[model samples]
Target chain A: MSIDTDDPTVAAAPDPEPDNSLGGIFRAYLAKLRGGEVGSLPAVLGLIALVVVFSSLRPEQFTNSFNFANLIGQSAGVTVLAMGLVFVLLLGEIDLSAGFAGGTCAGVLGVFLTRQEWPLIPALLAALLTGALIGLLIGLLVARLGIPSFVVTLAAFLGLQGVLLTMIGEGGTIPIRNDFINGLNNANLPVWLGWALGLLCIVGYAASTYITDARRRAKNLTVQPLLLWALKTGLLTVVVVAVVGYLSVERSRNPALTSLKGVPVSLVVIVGLLILLTFTLTRTAWGRHVYAVGGNAEAARRAGINVFRVRLSCFILCSTMAAVAGIMIASRTNSVNPNTGGETTLLYAVGAAVIGGTSLFGGKGRVIDAVIGGTVVAVIDNGMGLLDQPQGTVWMVTGLVLLVAASVDALSRRRASATGHV
Target chain B: MSPLLELHGVEKSFGAVQVLRGVDLSVQAGRVTALVGDNGAGKSTLVKGMAGIHLFDAGDYLFEGEPVKVTNPKDAAALGIEVVYQDLALCDNLDVVHNMFLGREMKRLRLVDEDTMEQRARETLDGLSVRTLKSVRTPVASLSGGQRQTVAIARAVLWNSKLVILDEPTAALGVAQTEQVLRLVRRLADRGLGVLLISHNLNDVFEVADDIAVLYLGGMVGQIDAASTTRERVVQAITTGVVPEGGAA
Candidate 1:
């Protein structure tokens, strides 16, 4: 791959490849993983180990379909909130106020819906707008005033908790009566609908991959072998279909409860969000700019990127996603209170992002890291509770897992840099 | 031919300390002009003025014989002038294509057209005969110093720059990498783009520069055709601000 001539156009093309077969691809992937391309591997492995250990300890409680569904529902709020934090974390910034900001947004929605008796859309809109404005204020302080994000968000954390307290008032809770909001956690899709949704996702993913591959081939670029693509798609399909089938099984012993066995609406919401956000963070130019800014703000500025604008947008997006998480939390509990979104909620969100593989050092992460990390946390919580462990035990296990995840991240990053693969 | 960029009596100061004082310099298309100076001789300040990072307080800044006021980097960029800073100004976390088209991405249907951008990046690198890179998708951090320098130069060239300024292009590079970069600079000039190279290494300055401009004590000492002068004369000019046999300033 050396250019020997002064005239580059006259240089001969380099050797192509030893193999373009399935075995070659597999070996390459193995080598890559060894070379520190271990994105989400630790989380996935942790998830498997949790399943094995928990099933051995409490098969009836942990392996039940109902409990699995509950785990997904429990993870929804943290997962969504963590998704927002992914953006901030990508820039190596922290939002200590994520939970409180979300709590305040939910409080706004609750007050408008119950006290003022407002329409649902307007109430939700007002909550989202309030979240955006909060983010804008924090972003302005960070970007315009040049305060470090950690300080600005820490102040917001305290201030927004106060806002939540005032909204709910002393020793009070607003019980949400809205059918749609409350049903977000309580309801489930029909079995057929759940299967159809899973099918849709699989088909959509495969189609996009095929189109990309075709485009690459047409351009005379290196394309992954069709067999390898099929293997990947087949593996994904099996996992998705298996999850759907498992969820579709009837969980209730009572003969009256016939339709409550499918995927929870909350799971669907989180998945939908996961898809939307993954697209935004991967396919869009805005997403690229976010990474660039997070990677090197000075370099980004030199490239003429409006660093202020990028940082502000990240804050706005994070707060807006946090607002959505707040709505989900309120929906699940049917109430908004002073205690909502406090007491380890923000810690879980940040932990979820970090444990899922998003770097605290910025510029290296994906939106899906939140999902993996959130699921891991939820499984630990669910499994520990099934083993008759106390909340403190669960906390310790979660903390240990978070520490392991961080060590994995740090080690992998160092290896990557050392190997010059970066 | 007339110089592509001409700076006449450019002056700048930070507070009371003047960094550039009435510096006159010109860069011709299809030629490499090396700007040599000592540590405090204001080479950086002069280059910054041309880059539009620090607008000259007093000067006739001309582009193609037309006087213009360049107050910012954007103004310089608008006139097809690109500066590859010594630090390279590359986000190490980003891949080569992203770094090449960082802020000004070629979008199709409002989305970053990665395919098109990748194609253009490949063409740009190929045009400059840079064949050492394994892939355009490789992150900047993985590249060797010489490859990184090439990426920086390729980025400057990709933007259709008429005058490309490189500051200390070979300072941190190994001997082989330095040779590769000097050749690339020669190729850039061969492509008819005006090149301003800033360096402390006179050996490099002599190897590739067509004309050499010496800066001493925040002022231009002389601008001499490189082949007509020797390293001792250039060193004397850089250190003493005078050519032994009366070179033109």
Candidate 2:
């Protein structure tokens, strides 16, 4: 109403002269829908391009369904731990101990279940508790002592490494013989179950997003355009379909052994954890406080948010998730030993998170970003492995990708602040 | 009338720089008390001390005509006092409703009660006459400066706030938005809130303030009714320690 008369400048020249061309308007809408996604477009496309390059380079091996399954199975533990690492990263903190912490948990679980004859469920709980306790210790040192997270966690990493070494007993190993634990690593869900689950998850996620968007829109919310929403749901559907399709086929060819089954249990567990973490981060008061602490500690403090508790909880969650990853890794390999923690695995987890576009400067990341980032890291590792790249080369390339992602995060942060968009 | 909040001989020093030197302030219910001073005139210090952000080194704070202690922000909040600092601390990623209930949320069955919070937040914002909000769910990042200020003010008010201290509330808003917020301030006073408005914008001060207490270099220069005092006199007291041509504390 005011546009017609109150602003003389807007009224003076206003004959609507095809203000937005169809193509321009369409393109603008595309750009808008791609809001934060724009910063990560390069990496997303890179994942695709890498797949193409790897498949062509080793068409016989890389393009095989078996190899693809192998890649997913192999990276499962890393990705799980990476997801947890993302939470710590979100607070602009580092958890150097996640790798060994998880490994220590594996040893703890191995001792409890395989040797002590504890049930797999209780044993796993004990392992998770162990991880959470480690995280709590780290959190206590950092929050109460006011020591930096990096320094504190670094010490925790070294200390946990020693503790793991001690637990496993001088390069000794625990052979996990539990049928249930082995089934989680070796077996898969039925193809129909996988497809049904995949479709259900995709539909559920999309519907939830749409419903939330509509609910907000009813409140006259400023929603991203419908096209953007469509694009997201569409892309999500494609990814789920592709993954389920790939997982449905037989990837094994041994006469005695079973043919490939379904998505690994770890993958299912990862998804469940992602959903839970996402809810905790986005929907809960505690999650909001984490963002608050990250965004402005002083401000959050003034708002009466218990900043220390938020930070401590993030660390606690990170390590607890790490413990879950450890349980998976121990089950997959059937042992906990000197190499249980794995070398540079924790660094890779951080690399995955940093590559996924989480800000090192904090207060500006999503759990989904970490999930996306974990997949990105997995894609690179898988692609490089298909090319028969050396372990050194894999680490080097991962480091480069991490650097690029960090740069992208920093640049995008600047752009967001400048445009006042974030 | 007796003061509802009193700061007697408050002093703040950072190293060798003493920002507030034996500053005295008195605030009462249902009135807008303006803290007027030049830049670096210890106005912020006095405000912080009053809001519990800073503890005065040598001051006795009297609340409701009795001496009280405020160790931190939580203590101040528990007493129904709120300070809207200059930066506001409004989360850019949060919406109006979320920002209003950021830390202190309505809980039911041990979970954040969405319905109760949303309804209350909507009411608080509506009461402020902030109709231009795009949505209560829109991230505060998209809000105009005035809208963001409205969110901060709403957050402060929604907490059952009694003594609302607004630090430079109209500093960056447009003329009309300033008028809107000033009116909101007036309504708050009418609700029997003790409002301590710290503003350099004398026009804004004159519009909403009931009594303008000038702070000049860590001292209580003078307290004058907005109805009786002229802008020239306030400005003079603000610039110099002495009140304009025959004013006194």
Candidate 3:
């Protein structure tokens, strides 16, 4: 028969029946890890190296409990901004104006809070709405009018800077008086509340991961081994508990205000955003659609996805995240000024995302990239500050790290394309 | 068997250009109807018309003998008509499971049900007797041309479609890969789909097609049974749009 069942090419080699057992899964994972399919490993390793080097060089300063807490605390603004950038970057797009657009959002809120004397909730909403409106305009221009995102956002970058300047006025500063808003970065959760929150996170993570893995196994689908899953869950539990434990230790030298020391408010906010975004990007059909659109727009369209809507939603999300990051920045500094969320802010956000291993060409990235990438940038800045490095030295070193990251991205992409593997 | 899909006297135009004129075509259930033509012979236009990318200006589109109107791809999809374009329509960055269930993802609790979707994707590939893939989790970009084509075909059938129109399925494949895909085409028909196989490869057409329809300059020469026709006559119709008076098409 021309259609022979034994045609070698037609049937190909039966892939070694997948070893679905724990040992087999472990072996497979090891293989992938060796192949550099282990996402975020590089960033984590870099972060660890930075922590060790900095602590050894300036143990008294870098290893201080206050510094450790402050490192995470100060990362909130750029971390959130980078999280937003990850969305756009995954779509193989860029938001050049994200930093200043965030600034504009903060300025709007600051003006309302300090100058217009608006209520906090209403002011907050207006500020967020302004961010969304800017994003909507950018989305329409990019998705509907077919303008390249680079051009549109570059225009936004300059235009939003102007808007921020106008709102705060030239060489002016607007001090945020709302205690609730101002406390966002500086406040710490009560020690008991911090432990409770950590426990909640561990439980939630364990339950969701276990339920989903169990469901997949029940359906006889490919699943990670139980041992591996348990190992991962255990590691997460340890990390969260340790973080809460560390944060709960009093860093205050002041005898009276020592009770105020606990997990910084920004840590909770950052973690919350991380979980929310990770779920959205991984577990939702809309997230899959965004990936498909980024991978191949025509294929997505042929598959009956509304490509325009996906693109628009992605831009809106990027902008909305920037708005949140802006608010965090305002909270941290207790004021909004012309220089807030300027060039370095956007630069660092993009750097953090890319350095943390988010692909510049989209369709492949994770929210966790921002978390890791943000830490790397913050540590570098923090380390240099302790060393009393000149401003030029800090810029030069950050630029170098970003270039290396870009090179890694380009190199890995080339290798992947050459090997025809993800 | 009656034709599952029939287009009667279909006409299409682009400004002053008439791309398809009074073309009549029919495809039966559980059969492969080969659509062949020279370059610029309106083969794509005819397929696009049926795919709902471009609607025929003047035609009666009949499904199971009932006239229907398909204004867009979504409408055609709703009617169980799927077209696998020449590009294969698979996202390179997505894994096989993801690509298989791109837009129509299975959901549980308003979230994508990855387990069910993966199982279904595996089952669909198994049903097609495709064993080349090491895992369904492999990205489409990592797949060979033939495997990608298989993925596209599997995706079309995964939706439980009644009719599948393939445009140049083997055009970019190698000799071995082409044979693999041709075998896959037969398997799809064996599964009882109404298959419209558009191709330029005469050997491929002869190997799998149950019926042959040749197009010449915006007009269909005729639809003839593949088993009863010779290559020379089919070529003659393709090149000149006319079979010798004594020869059967």
Candidate 4:
């Protein structure tokens, strides 16, 4: 496997393979490809280990299909919000205002649709645009005014909180009146339709891989072994299908009580976003530029890249995503209130991002990591609730898991650095 | 014919510290020029001025014998002058193609054209005979020093640069990697591009360069033919700031 040449740190590690045996050599090659090529395998596995530990603690509830669906629905907002956070974080900036952005946007959208009796389309656009503008203003302050993003965004966080409180008014609650928009929280495609969609997505992914590899191989180029490539794609397919089935089962079971269970429309939007972002970052040039700027701004600038444009773009993306998550939360509650977003939601979003394997230092991360990390958080939350643990215990447990994930990322980065993997 | 790039009586400073003092350098087409100097001898300052990162205090920069005042690095790039900094400015998380086209990616409808980018990246690397690399998709963090240097040079050439400035490409490379890089430098000059290579390693300078320029304490000491120069004399010029034949500063 060809190693990444940009990071001298990870590239400096001594070659660990010299054996010629077929089995041993192949395993070592896999490790090199999987471990060093795309971030870290340790962090990914650590996330799983955390999930396993939580499941073992409350096997009857955590491992159950109903609870697994609950986890997905519960984590959907945080996951989407964290995805946007990853963009800003990878640029080595903090958007502490993410929670507040979501809260204010959600409240604003509710007011537009319910109080003003506006249509859903205009209300949604206004909410998202407001969030984007907030981020744009913050970007301008940091990029042009020479203020640090941390300070600029922090001030925004506090200011947005006050705005949200005022918007909620002294009563502190406003119910959404629009039918089509409010039903987004309760809506779901049929279970079989979900399965079909899952299959279609998996098939599309496999086809894209086959076509790209075939074209490359026809030119006598270096293509990854079919077996290795298939192994990863197959795993992705299985995980996706299983998640759909679990959500479907939960939806079917809830019909016995309130007939109110299914894959929420917000969840679908979140998945669609994941696919869009993954394609943008991995398969596009702007994604490459973003990674370049994050990796080394000076180097990127010298290469004739517009460093300012890429950074500003990241902030815009991040705030727009937070707005979407805020809309989802508001839809789920069917109400906007002062307490819509708080310290708990903000901490969870940040934790989910770190757990997803985005580097605290920037220039390394995946959108998929956010999804997995969000799931891990939901697993812990849903399982602890089943065990009847106090809210404090839930917070402590999540904090510990977040700490471990962060430690894994830090150690791997040092390893990558020491080995000249830069 | 006149030199491809000419720096006539250039003077530059940073803050209150004077760095380049009326330095004049001429790089002819189809030849390798080596820059040698002591640690604080203003080599970086002179190069930075030419690269447009630092505007000269007083100088006339001529391209094709016409005086041109460059405002920034962007102008230099548009004029086909590419400078590969000592640090190389590569992002490890990105693949070779991504690294090569970091800021200027080919996109259609706001999406990167991966297939075409990969095709071109492969062609550039292959043309250079960079055999050490296994795949264009491999992250740069995994390449050996020699391979990483190859990627940087390829990127400069791919952008259709006329003059290439490499800052100490072999300083931290191993023996094999150094040999690989020196070979690439020789090939670049053979392609008729003007190459200004900065190196402390006399061995590398002697092996690849056709002409050598020496600097001492923010001033040009002398420019001599590489074939007629010796490592000992070069070291002496660097340390004692005396060329012995009269042109010291």
Say which candidate scores most in lDDT: 1
What is the iRMSD of the candidate numbered 3? 5.6
- Please list the C-alpha lDDT of all candidates, in the order they appear: 0.88, 0.77, 0.87, 0.79
Model 4, residue A47: C-alpha shift (Å): 5.6
Candidate 4 stretches with Cα past 4 Å from truth are A1-30, A33-60, A250-262, B13-22, B57-59, B65-67, B108-110, B216-221, B232-249
lDDT of 2 by residue, B30-58 (tens): 88888888988888888777777788888
**Clashes (candidate 2):** 0
Name the runs in model 3 displaced over 4 angstroms: A1-27, A33-38, A256-260, B244-249
Cα shift from native, residue A376, model 4 (Å): 0.5
Candidate 4 chain A: worst 10 consecutive residues by lDDT?
A9-18
Tell me candidate 2's TM-score on chain B.
0.93
Go through the candidates in order and give each one's DockQ.
0.48, 0.28, 0.51, 0.42
What are the runs in model 2 whose C-alpha is more than 4 Å off? A1-40, A115-117, A206-234, A254-257, B1-31, B38-42, B53-72, B93-96, B108-123, B131-147, B170-194, B201-208, B216-219, B244-249
Highest TM-score: give the candidate number: 1
Off by over 4 Å in 1: A1-15, B246-249
Q: Mind giving the per-residue lDDT tens digits that candidate 3 earns over B58-122?
A: 97999988899999988899889998889887888798999999899999999998888888888
Candidate 4 per-residue lDDT, tens place, A1-422, comes to 35444333332211333344456447656655545333545546765776687678878767776666556667877888889988888888788888888888998898898889888899899999988998898888877787998899889989999999998886679898676666665567677778777888889989988888888768655565566567768897888876776677653445667554445566677788999998888777678777887888887877777888888888888888988888777777778888676567777888888887888788888897788788778777887788899999998988888898888777776665555533
Return the lDDT, model 2, position A379.
75
Candidate 4, residues B151-189, lDDT tens digits: the string is: 888898888788999999988788878888898989889
Q: After superposition, how far is residue A210 of candidate 1 from its true place, in Å?
A: 0.9
